[model samples]
Target: MSTLTEELANTDLLWDVPQATLEFLAEHSAPRTLASGEVLLCPELENGHVYLLLTGTLTVHFGTPDSPMIRELAQGSSVGEVSIIDDTRPSAYVIAKETCRVFPIHRHLIHQLLAESNPFARNLLQMLTRWLKSNTQRIVSDRMQIWELTDQVNIDGLTGLYNRRWLDNAFPRLLTQSWKKGQALCVLMVDVDNFKSYNDDNGHLGGDRALMAMGEVLKTTVRPYDFAARYGGEEFLILLPNTSLNEGVAVAERIRHCSESKAVAYANEHSVPGITVSTPLPNITVSIGLALNQSDSVSELIAAADAQLYRAKMDGRNCVRY
Candidate 1:
């Protein structure tokens, strides 16, 4: 309802700014409106001006110059200042998502104001700098929070490893990188042998202990570059970079042997048989199959390794091979 300058005066954002300083900005900044589908600037080019949203909305976008991924902008938000300060590529394409009115404040005019009055200009600069700092901090905190939330969403409760979601997110990237590098990246699929019978015979508690031990073995036995994640129920997966099927099988064998050597203990009174402070239960076994990343599609790699795992189970539950 009110004019842009009137809105600025009432917003209280520039309340700390001196009266003379406000008069100078009034002369310098311009009120401009962009239609619903209009683009004020392509952030990829020069960050020509900074904008303060007076009314309406905008969208930050991705994609080609003509077609973009549009995301919303709220009222009272400022734009383009971040690019001016950091000199980095723009994070997204910003366009007027709706009929938006922006008060564009040119940096050249602000510099001129600085020359006109030292105290007033210094005060305004300090305020702007502080706002930018606070804004950057909030963005960083938000990203960290989102990362934690994503981890919780995409992680398996039973094995503390990446679940199906993460595989969907990362496997394609891995395949591309491996193909580009002309080096093999391998996937090793591991499963505890007779896990159902073990659960039936010893209970889920026994199966859990075995799972934990096997997870630990995978962590310790693999190369430094390898990443291991619980694939799903009674299943685990490991990524081996720059490795051939032969080398991958060797790593899988190491993990299998390590898990088999360690005995698992049950907390229940009679589940594991021999219960002691040091040693609580008998050793358990796992079977692992290695699939070369360069040689297989994501699904094919997983299936190949799984098929090999089935073979390991048939051969006798406690082995690892390519």
Candidate 2:
């Protein structure tokens, strides 16, 4: 590390160093103190400063609909690097998690830092590397999280799949195409049997876990090009273009069977019991209902699946009623 760089690390603001590429910040860089809980970088909002926390913690969050717990930043953790690095929208909301102090470099200062210093260059490279690394990790983590989050709007949160919203947006177009082609339009409504009790008995969180698991079940069991999404709390809707009611039901049964065989670790349990009385509940099961809409509006299709789902629940849990 350079002396300038080390100095840069100490003060609330890093002023001069050969590491920076531009000398113009000799005129513009300033310092500020951020009290705890202050918002520094808003996810959906915009600001021009690249906030570098000199002390305390920061929390980074997203705009998810339900239980949107997100990232935390320690001292030395930087925010707004993406905006500084490129011209793009801010991807997350940031708040000072604790009493914090920061060096808020205006965009001009950022360009100066990039243009004038060596360590700044090195630091920029390192930050970029860190940024790239953080981004890559983010991509993987977000993919998994997108896999995990429930209650997504426009599409189903489970299955990492499309939903009624998708159909609402696409079905009209799809129907038009199908109408012109004189082809069969296959729409499936899939319900997890007794899911109300599944979530209710397990607790909402447990229900979320189950739904997430069920989503994976559908993804794995279905053929490519078939789209599925959590239609609502416990039911998922599927659309199979260019297929028959028979084909759609066939896929639904496979999904149902997969759910029955599918078992989750039963999160509410305490400790493992089998490995010398340590394993948790052995498994949890799912029941499903299948309904197909071959010659009706999207509403009718969803209604049909929902009806079957109700029947499945009424008949028994863990069985598929098609």
Candidate 3:
């Protein structure tokens, strides 16, 4: 096996350096062995040396040691360079992914090499540039992943509308804003009329398509500032800010009308092999219950709208009740 000096000579940081310099670095640096899962660096602690990975792998984690790793450092990769360069605590945790060996070059020696060796300075700069580029790409990729995950968590899969989970988080904040501003807010609790019968006749797939169509109608019909979400199975909720009961009722009527008129087109699942057929589903209607915000609490507003919704269902479906 190669000695620590030989490994140092092959690293990007010491490339093209004189043998005398490499010998000096080896003399000053000490070899350290790390077990798997060892924490090599942390944001809360200061790192005084730059570590050169001689064998095995290391992982960089942004948050905690147990958090998902953001980057992997293989053999020939360097660690703790950023904190040494900036003279600050490490910004992330570096942990050994497996049993590894590293050469730790102290900060004093690093500064000495930077001052004395032109090649060392050039190589360090190049290494830092590559590190920065990779970090930038990783950041962009992570952001995109986070956005997609957030969308998936908050949106209903069948309807393509915001799900109840999103509503639970958002409705309280919206209600608070309206209350603080002393502006009117209305909640519409909408449900599909005789939805079980429709599902019984057309099957669950058809019911899903109908819900998707309803989602689209709400997306197109609601004002820009209004919020809509799938409350639960076959039930949806709409929030209109700065609107009175009359305005809420008008919006509900429009939604009801649109739902009644729209026809959902779906592929016939029972189609014969090798032949595709598209059919328009029978039109559906909605019962809407509107309640203007008279209470400060989110639960109270929702409860009031729910009561009205029950009334609409009792008064015969397909109409709005306020």
Give the Cα lDDT of each candidate: 0.72, 0.64, 0.90
Candidate 2: lDDT over CA atoms?
Answer: 0.64
Per-residue lDDT of 145 in model 1: 99
* Candidate 1: tens digits of C-alpha lDDT, residues 1-322: 2354566554323434456655667776777989988877675577756677778887776665456554466776667765654665566678887888887777675456457766635555665687668779978998999999988998776666677788777877887788788989888888877778888877788778777776667767877877788877878888887888788877887888888887776664644568544336567778887777645378887888888888887888788766
lDDT tens readout by residue for model 3, 217-289: 9998899999989999999999999998888888999999999999887766657988777799988899998
Model 2 worst lDDT run, 10 consecutive residues: 274-283
Where is model 1 more than 4 Å wrong at Cα?
1-117, 263-281, 293-296
Error of 3 at 255 (Å): 1.1
Which candidate would rank higher by lDDT, 2 or 3?
Answer: 3
- For each candidate in turn, give its C-alpha RMSD to the true structure in angstroms: 8.7, 10.2, 3.8
Looking at model 1, residue 97 earns an lDDT score of 75
RMSD of 2: 10.2
**Rank order (by lDDT, best first):** 3, 1, 2
TM-score of each: 0.59, 0.46, 0.80
Question: Residue 258 in candidate 2 has what lDDT?
Answer: 77
